[model samples]
Target: MKAMTYERFGNADVLELKEVPDAHPGSDSVLVQVKAASINPVDYKVRQGHLKGLIDTVFPVIPAWDVSGVVVKPGLDTPEFEVGDEILAYARKDFISNGTLAELVEVPVRTAVHKPKELSFEEAAALPLTGLTALQTVRRAGVSAGQRVLIHAAAGGVGSFATQLAVLAGARVVGTASERNHEYLRSLGAEPVTYGDDLVESARALAPEGFDVILDFAGHSAMQTVPDLLRDGGIVASITDHRARDVYGGQYVWVRPDRANLAELAGLAARGSLKIEIAEVFDLAEAAEAYRKLETGHVRGKIVVRV
Candidate 1:
């Protein structure tokens, strides 16, 4: 199998395409022949060793978590999948060694889900991580029908999904992005507000009484904006801020793989209730360029690598 790997933590420049040996799976896993895989900001962050203390790493690491592919081999006890089954997963592991940025990846059954029939391989590959983050984050913030929710970075990967899911849940959604993405957010049913100098006031202008819940997928900017945006007793959840919990008495989220949740997201995508935007698609060997583009933080949607 050919895959991209890095012998040490650095940047996209350190990654190289190499012919690696095939991977075998444990009894609870499935061996997937990769069709498409998507890159997240974490992919580049992990490549640069940002999460070094939290996640153990090995040399020659293949870095990625999102995968959309066909199951070529199911491990002995993995009845959830079989040969020829199309699958997708957030495919993260307890430790870093093998990943989905390759021609073949071993996915644990717990992280795998059937792909949405309506989505192409690239679109299916885009959902697992970003979609799950948005779903879990909004839920943590107690988003529900009739509630006014504020989402930071609403046009980016996680925020885009958050906006749609919040709207699907019947929440009045307001998302923050650049002016360029305002129309895009409106199409997704969110009231788009631009980010910058007066974000707090801009958000307040949209919801005078304050938002019922706020989901921060951007950064600590939420920490500064939450006081003005969230109503008293309103909840908050953040994937990017560790300081959010202490300041807002809210949840600091780290997304975990849940098969049921993945299935639900897939169903939503299939039903046209959720939309995935593929900002760019690169061939597998162009993974280094993919990671670099993802690191730019300006990508409007998911970046995919077709294997």
Candidate 2:
């Protein structure tokens, strides 16, 4: 099978299209014939060796965790899915090899869920990692009706999902984004605040009483405002900044793959309540170019590679 691979960590230039051994399912896994895969910032960060201490590097690593495809075979011990079932998965493992960027991927049943019939393969591929991150962060913060919520980087991939989910949960959301994306954030049901030196003041102007919950998807000093923005007993959660937990008495979120949460997102999408945005799509052979686009750091939604 052909895959986008990198033997060593570095720049996007290190990625190559090459033939590799085909992947098969293990006892608790399924073999998926990939239809689409999405790129996350973590993909490039992992390629640059940023996660060296957390995840061991395996040579000739295939990069990407989000996949949407059809099951070609299921493992002998796996009974949740079968051949010809359409599915999506956040196919992350302890090691950084055998990822979802290949034509064939081995996905564990624990991380896999049925794809919503309403979503295209590209849209389904875009949901797992970012969707899971947003869903988990919102739940961790315990956002509820009538509360005032603030979301950093609310126009980005995970932030977009978080914004909508919070709105659906009945929180009045204020999202930080650039001026160009303010309207986009508003479309996701958030009141937009331009992120900058005036961010805190701007957020205060919207909710002078202080926010009932704040979620940080952007790490660039976003946590510094917690003291000024959060109401007493209000919760804060961050996916990017660890100081939210260590210093601010908040939670630092690491997204975990859960079959139940994935199913909830699928159900939302199926009901036309959750939206998946595709900023761009690249062919399998052009995955390197796709990574280059992702590294630009300004994409509003997810970027996908079609197999």
CA lDDT of 111 in candidate 2?
97
Report lDDT (CA) for all predictions: 0.91, 0.94
Worst 10 residues of 1 by lDDT: 220-229
**TM-score, one value per model:** 0.98, 0.98
What does candidate 1's lDDT look like per residue over 1-307, in tens digits? Answer: 9999999989789999999999878899999999999989888788888988998988789999999999999999998887999999999999988999899999999999988678899999999999999888888877899999998899999999999999999999999999999999999999988888888888889999998988889995667877778899998889999767987899999999999999999999998889998899999889999888888889898999999
Candidate 1 CA-lDDT value: 0.91
TM-score for predicted model 1 compared with the true structure:
0.98
Backbone collision count in every prediction?
0, 0
Tens-place lDDT per residue, model 2, 44-88, is: 999999998998989999999999999999999989998999999
For this target, which candidate reaches the highest lDDT against the unseen true structure?
Answer: 2
- The residue ranges of model 2 lying beyond 4 angstroms of the native Cα positions read none
Give lDDT for model 2.
0.94
lDDT of 1 at 279: 95
